[model samples]
Each structure stands twice: as structure tokens, then as C-alpha cells.
Target: MNLSICVLPMHEHLIKVAVVGHPSEGKSSVIATLAERDDIRISARSPETRECHSYDIQVGNQTLLELIDTPGFQRPREACAEFKLYEERIGTDNIAATFLAEHGQDPRFDAERKILTPLAEGAGLIYVVDASRPISKDDRHEVEILRLTGRPRLAVINAKADESTHMDAWYALLNSTFNLVRPFNAHRASFAERMDLLRALGQLEKSWQTDIDAIIAAFQVDWQARMDECAEAILDCIEAIVLLRVAKTCNADDRREKERVAQQVADSYREKCAKRERECHQAIRRAFKHQLFDPAPVTELQHGLLDEETWRLLGLNSRQLRRALMMTGAALGLTADVALAGVSLGVGTGTGAAAGYLMGRYAMQPLSMLRAHTRKDSWLSRSMRREIYLGPARNLQIVFVLLDRALGCAHLARNWTHARRDHESIMVTRPTAATKEWSQVDRDAISRYHVAILKGSSEQVYERRTAVRELLVKLLAS
Candidate 1:
């Protein structure tokens, strides 16, 4: 989402936090999760990062926070020994700056210098450790080094797996030296957990409290705006697919030609609907800040939209389908009654309701488009010209199916963390229909919206679209 609101003034200090740790301790993963950035490279291989990189959390033109991903400490014991000796010799508390002054250009201390550059420059520290592993002497040395830097520090125990057998040991050691310690799973951190981590940053320094709160607020607002745009995209996709129609001019003398055109129109309608749905899902992914990963492949998603499993899993049940159909048909009947000046004494309403019930019973059948019919192009033409029409879908099941699929996409986009790189594991599965849990009011709103689209009433469409969009925004928020 391109956040345009200038939440902070240009003169405000850009909060800088350095993510530092031992080699292969999930420092990069932590940064990736916190920055909401998947472009940051994360690997299980040792010494993957050889240099420092910066990621800025910005809204519009203003930078809110700057997270520096520094190279992991390769010689923490040696660095700690040197720092202790220097502090003893100089009788000073500013050991980090003094060490950098002496060894900033030394080749042997390249990694150490790079790691301490941000700390010496007054950046807050987020030290990551693999809590799933046993504590080592080097880990202690690393903790001592950060303690001597005198920067406000937050220790993050990034447990790579579900195993927390060594968590208590790590926490005990971290609590003595760090201002705050928290266990954050980089691979599976939720939106709320990420926010909690930000709040913890606010507590590290009293001077940083207001800035941290403002950054958190900006992030919340940015996320909500993304969801609102997603809601708009979903609504637009539904309208496009629901009102979709295809046509072709056919010859008057050729019956076989007309049949061929009808078949072509059907194919076109399916292809167009599938394509539009894919585009909408992609838009949702972008809104959630997904740039490198896709929940599923394009062909897989396109075929899955109308696949049998998707229909069975996501389409509305018999009872719900009946209610939706009856509601829509009753509205249509009311329109007809108004046209007839109420002369048909409630007959239209009864017939429409019965028809709706019958259609509902058959709604779960195989997907099919409305039968193609031909109409004269114009009466003034010299020769009779006919046009064949193919859609505005006949089966109401497609509406429910499409909605469920869009919701599933939004769900994955919002919840999929950037630290996850295993493509197969992140691939989209047939999601349970979230609409099954929606209340009657929600269902009624959808039905009315569908009716509005079908009737092609511009004013009714505007009102109903607003209602449905508001419903979707609430759902996505939850």
C-alpha cells in the first residue's frame, strides 16, 4: 500500500535501531519481519551477511524508523576482551566509540567495526539470539560487548522452531544485561505480535516513547488503508464477474455458425472471469506488502476458482443458498409488481419465491453459464443482423464462491510473514468458507448487493456497493 498521509514532520528524528547478533542467529529474519519486507535476503547458511543493509519504515515522504541489518559478530570473544582492556586503560564509559576510533580501518576488525558502527552512532539495539540452541561462551561475550556500548537494548530470542527447551536459559542471561527481552518467532509472527514488539521498543527509552507511539499509529493506519483498498478491489472484481457478458454478431443464413458463436462466447466469459479474479487477488497481495512471494501459481489459482473442490469447500450450503435466492427473487418480483401497478394481486411475489426455491435446490449442480440467445441488431438495417449474448451468470453459487476465494487470498496475504521462504509450504490450499460464520445481516447485505448488480440500477448499485465494501473492511480487519 502506498501510504500518502504525512504522519510525521520532516524535522522529526528518524528512529534508528540496529539488528545485531551472532552468525546464523536469525537477525536477518527478525529485521525482515519487523520491517514488513520480504526483499531482505534470509538464509540458514552460516555467515550469509557480510555487510550492513538498512531498511526504512516510511509513510509517504516521511521516514518513521530505520532498521539497520548489521553483520553478525564473528569474533565476539576477542572484541569483548579488547573492549574490556580499552575501558580499563582509558577509565571511560565510551568504550565503543574509542574502539572504533582505533580499529575502524583495520581489516581484521572489519565485521566488528561494521557491527558497532550503528551502536557507536547512538542507534538502539535489537540483539537477536537463537533461543532453541544451548548458550555458549561466545554468546556471553556478545552480550557483554553490547552491555558495554551503553545503548538502550532490547534482546530478542528468535526461536527458529517450536522447541523452547533452551528459552529459560537464554532469557535468564538476557534479563541481566538487556533493558527488555521478548520471544519473537520470525517465521510466524502475527500482526499483533509485531505491534507488541514495536511497543516494547517504546519502553526502552523515555525520550523515544512519543516517537514510537507515532510510528505504531502510522503503521496501524497504513495497514487499515491497505485493507480498505483491498475491499474496493474485491468489490470491483465481484461486480465485473457478476455483470460480465460476451457477444458476437452471427450470420442469418448459418445455423451452425450461430452455434459456434455461442460456444465461443461461453469460453470467453469463463476466461475473462478467471483473469479478472486473478488480477484482483494479485492486487490484494501487493496491498499486504507481498512483492516476492505468491500464495499460489497463476494457472493453479485460475483453474481452482471453478474447480470442483473449490465449489464443494467454498460455495454456500443449501439452506443459505435458498435464503439468498429467495431474497433476490422477492426483490425482482417487487419490481415487477410496481411495473404492473399492483394488478397482479401478489401473484408475482409468490411465483418469484417459488422459482427461487427451485433454483436454490439445483444451485449446487455443475457450473454453467446462461444459455446464449440471439437478438436483432437493428430494425433499420437492410439485412437482418443478429447478435448472440452469453452471460451475467445464471447460477448464484458463483457469487459465493468468488467471495470466498477473495477472502481466502486476503487472509493469506495479511498473515503470511516475510521470514517464510519455503514456497511449497506457503502455497494456497482450499480454504474453509469464512462466510459460513457470518450473521444473517451480513448475508442479507450480500444478497441485496447481488440483486443491485443484476438489476443494473446505478443508484441502487452505489448504495449496495458501499454496504458490501463496509462489510468486507470489517471482515478483513478481524
Candidate 2:
């Protein structure tokens, strides 16, 4: 028997960042948001993180950054007092370890030891503080203790939903102890805010700059890829909905009976299209890495999608839709004016509009092909003379309806913070007004994409999807 082992090269260049602060100051929330992991512990009732825990930011096989979550400082004032005793005796670099040794058995300093051990070992600091509330003596003392460690540090002001009266006080206080101070609301900050924080993190230390830049670059690339995947998912779903067809042989010559049975098959076709659109939404959620069972969001969209409210709330109105179509048509050198009546359509009824109406596009002409084909039902004899084909989705408006739902869902996922743990939903509330007009570029890209998806091959579909993805990423940026 031969024994073989493979040793994976572990990179030592990964930056270690320790997030610390007083209890309930959002130390864990900062880690949860930065790591983008909803599974991490975040509590509203009390402090959650009781010991040191690590979360990694990895790209493919590489780990670019490691965030260490430590227990919040329980005795910051006393810890600082004890650590200061040796500033004149022992060197500044040794005061933290000296405090840990002397207070290891002291019950009050238990949390302090847990927080200081990471900093003593060379991790840069991210001191989280509540900027919404006025700074207390305890907050100041906590910053002083972290400062005594003499490590490169960044102070992060974690503003809760409504705590903003002390932003200036926090900035003025934190600037004295840390290299940089930034006010960030972990629960509601958008993608751009997070990126801005990362950029500031890179400036805390020169040696860690390379790793921080790598982290930022990898994050940006991953986000763009996710948007592209979402676009692809939407396109695939649209194709399935358009090409869906169900047929049965008809024996009776009565036109009424044929239409009735055709309606039943048509219902089945609609059911499948609905299911495909749902899967596409799921795919978009997965692309955004939101795996939590969030039925609230889905239910809200479903109610709106079923009642046809989301189309009115988030999608382009009739005028915008018509204008979009005209713009799309102009890009393709076709002069087509479309009039779309806004109505509350059933699941697969006259759905939403795309570039106004694409009803007569050569690639989208399903009526001629639908009526020309016939399939024999195995249950019926060959004497049947007719086959009724209900659809290949000639109405392009329904595609817009599904696209609206996808966009709505993606928007929620992009802004949602992993720090939240409840059934709280995103995009649940109706917007005060309908969405604004899309830029000519976004509208034109959407129009061109509509054409490619209708007639293009797989490669062409991918190319068009990529074009749309570029615009989506810009929208998601902040």
C-alpha cells in the first residue's frame, strides 16, 4: 500500500481584521454584514457573540480577507486603567499582553481578554460604535483600550435605524484613537457604501493594502458576475415562456368545443410559464446569495404579480413602455407604434408590454406556426381532423411582467443586509410613484436584448444578456 498526500499552499498574505466594541454596539452585525453571511449570530435582545469567531472572504480557492468577531468589551474602563499601569514600566507594545496575564482570572475582564487576544496577535482593528446614540464614557474607554494595543485601526460608526444625533461626536472622538473613522449603517447600507468602507480599510495600513485591494477587486468581479447570471436566468425563462405549447387532437367539428378544450390546454401552458418564471426568480436570488427562506418577499411579489400591482408599482407605465418600444424599434430600423392598455391581467392573460408591442416581429410570429402544426392524441382515433395549438407566447408584454418581478426581487436582495434575522421583507411596500424612465442606454439595451432573445442562437443570447448585465450592475452599484 502506498500513502500519498497533497499539501495545499496556504497564503499568508490574507489580512486579519478584528471587529471590537462595547456590548450591543453591533460588533457582530458589522461582521455579519461584511461577511455577507446571514447564518452568523446577530441579536436584538442581547449581545450574541460570546467568543472569538472567524469568517473568511474567499474568491474561488483563494482567501483574501479574514474577519474575526470578538466578544464586546465588558470592562473597558477597568481594562484601560490596568493596561495604563505599565505604559511607563513596560513598552507600549507589551501592555496589552501584560493586562491579559494579570486579568486572566478576573471575572470582569473575561470579555476584555477575549477581545484583546486577537489584537495582541497582530490583527488590525475595526472598532464598532453606535453613532446614533451620544457617546458615553464606556465608549470612549473602549476606544482607548483598543488604542493602547498600538495596532492599525479603523473606527466604524454603526448607526441603527434611527440613531443619528451623535454622528459628529463619534467622528470627533474616534479620530483621536484610530487611523480612519467612517459612519456606516450596517443594516441599510447599499453595495456602494460597503465598497467605500472596503476602500477606506485599505488605507489603514500600507502592508495590508495589497490584500485589501484584492478583496475589493474580487468582490466587484463577483458582483458583476452575479448580475450577468441574473440576466441569463431571465432570458432563459423568457424563452421557455415564449416557446411553450400544448396541443391535442380534435374530433368534433364544432368550433365552440375546440376553443373550450384549447382553453384548458392553454391554462396548463400558463401554469408552466408561471412555474418557470418562479424558478427564474429563485435563480436570481441564488445568484445574489440570499438562500434564506424569505416567504414574505415572495408572497408580496406574488400578491402584486397576481393582482398586477407590481407592474404598476415597479415597472414602466404605458407611456414609458410605448416609448421604450419605439426606442427599441428605432435601434432595429423598424418603424412600429404600439398602444398598450394598462389592465389587471390574470396570470397569463394580456400581460405587460415590451418596447410597446413586438407582436409582428418575424422571429416572434407564433400564430402562423401554431396553426400549421398538428399532433395526434394517442387516446383518440386517427379519424380526428383538427389539432389546436394555443400559443408560443406571441404577447411580449407578459415577458415584461416577469422581468419586472425579477428586477424587483433582485433589487431587494442587493440592498438587504445579512444582519437582519426576522421575516422582514424587502420591496413589500408600494413605491410612492411608478419607477422613473429608464435611460436611453438601459432602454435600448433592453430593446436589443428583446430582439436577440426572440430569434438569436445560444451564443447570441449570451452576448445580449451580457450587455443587459452591464447596465444592471450599474443600477445595483449603489
Candidate 3:
């Protein structure tokens, strides 16, 4: 299909949650467990994803929320030993490296990287350590990394059924490190256990309570404004075409000709709407300074890939490097089209440029930043204020972009359903005035049309314009 790209106004709001941890800590398994829904897909194993993988979890209709799984820190036995010797020579009393060195040769370091990167990205850490093993200094070091991330974190001691003594020590050590601690049997963690984990996440901050509310409010307002502008743009296109159609059909009183004109107008609108959606996606990526949409490796190691010099040069724990690469790849694959389309449509062009300047001046209206700020009342509230201020707004942007795409498509197709059952089919068939209509067809069509415009899909805008042209043609014929 020939696609004509165009710029459409964009709404800004998104939430980004990064899940971090050491390698082999079941980070991927956790994501798979959380995203059992059909819409979500976990990428296949790769060197980078050995630590981090990001998933865009669909929470509701027209919403896409991001969850980034990060790698854990995995220090090799030799590295751990060297680190300990270095620390000892430096007169430091830290023994975490010594403990890790003793256990590093064990298969456990592989799991550590799977857990740590996500934690560092401010995903409320879900530290999962083997309860069957004795509480060691390595676990303590992992906990220290969690603490350093400064995000609200919880420890999940994966209870091994036969080991009660080691579990006790694990619990004690976890309590000393994290504010919340829970025991989970990963092999057989129940749904209730998962809910308990979510509950722990919910209780971490009161910011969760009011933050989403404010974000939703801001998004709704901004989205509505964008929709109105889209409607206006569509209407303009329709009026232009309708006038031309009326002139062509000299029988200005023929109802059939008028209907034909409206159909044509709607078709034009749909095309424009599709283009706009592409533009919005591009704009969002540019705003974040993200070039590739799919995750790509940030660094490469040659010859001695795991050498100490290479590790130090990368500046990331094995898990962090893994997650970063996975995230880069995922970002590249998932949103490459949007990025390319946005650039082509001038979505990233600065206000100094004519096209961009015109858009900012005519399309987007600035709102007060005061309303987006977080309120502080108590000590806990003060501590959570930063998260409250940024998290919801970020999440809102993510939701906005996804919804914009879905709604924009719906408007072009002139139909909206709660499910994606026939979305692909609907997108292929161009609607015309000859199609059977239900009650309030015009209003429904117009509402969906407006939604498409707001979301910035050139295809939908074109479809609506085409329908309007067909309607005008029928009017003129009558």
C-alpha cells in the first residue's frame, strides 16, 4: 500500500518503569508472569536481554504502559576476589566482595545480573534470592545496589521448600536491607502471592494514590484539546473538497450525488489521520532523544568479551549491560516506524523552523506547570514527592501515544470496538457512503473522526474528509 505521510498534532504523556536485577534472577520470568496477556510479547533470549527487557503492558483500552526489566550485577569469582583484595589493600572493611568471591564460582552469579538493572532503573526492586542458600555477603552487596537506586524496594525471598534454616537467615538479612520483605516460592508462587507483591508496590508511596489521578486529568484535558484541533483540521479538509464536489456536480439538488461527495470526503480524512498517527509516534521518540525504536547493544566486547578491562570500560555490571542492550534492541524494534515517520513529518523539528513553529503556534497551547507539580504535606509525602511529580506524567505520555494510534485508526475505519478482534480487517476496507448506517451514524462517525485527528493519523483524517465529500455530493445532487 502506498502510504502518504503527514504531520498531525501530538499529545504528550507516558510512564516508564524499569525493573532491574542481576542476571539469572528470573527477571524475564517475572515479566512473562506479569504479562500473560495476548497483546504483550517477550522477546527471545539475546546477549543483551540476559539482563533487561522492556514490555509495553496494555492496562486498558487505548493505553500502553512500559515496564523495563533490568539485569542484575554478576561479578565473576576472579573479579570478586580481585575486588576484595583491592578493597582490603585500600584498608576498607567491606566484606561483601569476599563473600561473593567464595560463592561466585557457583551458578548463582548468573541469576544475580537478571535482578539488579531493573532495580537501578527505579522499578521498586523485587530482590529474589535463593532461600536454599545461606545468607551471604554477595546478597548484601546486591541489597546495597538496591539501596543506592533510591527507589522504593522490597525483598522477595524465594523459599526453597526443604531449607528452613537458610530461609530464616535470608529473611533477617533482607529485613535489614529493604523496607518490605516477603517470601515467594517462584516454582509455585500463587496468584495471591503476586497480588501481595503488587500490594507491597502500592503501599510504597501515597504518591501512587493521587499521581495517576493528576496525570489522567492532564492527559484528558490535553487529549481533548488535540481532538478539537484535529476536528477543525478535518472539517477544513472536508469543506474544501465538498465545495469542489458541489461545483463539479451541476445537479446541486441531487441527494445521491451529495451522499457520494460525503463518502469521498470521509476517505480523504482517513488517509490524513493515518499520517498524523505516524507523526505523533515520531515526535514522542524525538522528545526523549531516542533514535532507534528497537533495543540495540550499547557496547560490544571483542576478543576477551568478559575480561576485567572490558568490564571496567563498559562501566555496567554484567546485568546492566545486558539490560541496556536488550532495552536498546526492544526500543528499536517496537517503535522504529514512529521514529522515522516523525522525522519525515517534521515532528522533531524545533520551533525555529517554519513547519514546527507553525504547529507549536497553531496546534499546541501551553498549560501551567503548577498543576503538574506534586503537593507535599507529610514526611513520607515529602520523600515520595519526586516520584509523584514525574512518574504519573511519564506514564500518561505512554498511554496517550498508544491510545492516539488506536483511536486514530478507529476514526479512519469509522468504527470502535473494545477488542482488537477485527482491527486488521477494518483497517483494510475503505468505508463509503453506500455502506449501511446505524442510528446516529453521522454523530458516531464525526466523533471517531475527531478522535483520529487529535491522535494525528493522516489516514483517518483523509477518511473523514472523504466521507464529508461524499455527503456533500449527495446533498448537491438532491
Clashes of each: 0, 3, 137
Candidate 3's residue-wise lDDT over 1-478, tens digit each? 0111222113333334555444445454454444322132223244245545566533232223355666556653443454446455653333333334444566655545344334433345566666776756666666665554456666666553566878677777778777788775543443345445555654565544233333333333443443444433435533332222111121234556545544444344334433443444343323222232211111111212112332233222233223332332232232322212222343443222233223222121111100122223345642422211211111111112223232232243211211112223433432222111213444334334433444436887678756644543332222
Q: Point out the worst 10-residue segment of candidate 2 by lDDT.
A: 338-347
TM-score of each model, paired residue for residue: 0.89, 0.78, 0.32
Model 2: colliding residue pairs: 132-163, 325-355, 352-397
Residue 94, candidate 1: Cα error in Å is 1.7
Model 1, 238-356: lDDT tens digits are 88887788889888668899888877876777688889998898999988888877754633454566666666777688788877777776776634332222223344534556655
lDDT of each: 0.79, 0.67, 0.39
Instruction: Please list the residue runs of candidate 1 whose C-alpha ends up more than 4 Å from where it truly belongs after superposition.
Output: 1-11, 249-259, 296-302, 334-350, 370-388
lDDT of 2 by residue, 270-292 (tens): 56766887887788777766667
Best by TM-score: 1
Q: Which ten contiguous residues of candidate 1 have the minimum total lDDT?
A: 336-345
**10 residues in a row with least lDDT, candidate 3:** 294-303
Instruction: Tell me how far the alpha carbon of residue 366 in candidate 1 is from the true structure, in angstroms, after superposition.
Output: 4.9
Task: Give per-residue lDDT, candidate 3, residue 391.
Answer: 14
Residue 262, candidate 3: C-alpha displacement in angstroms: 63
TM-score of 3: 0.32
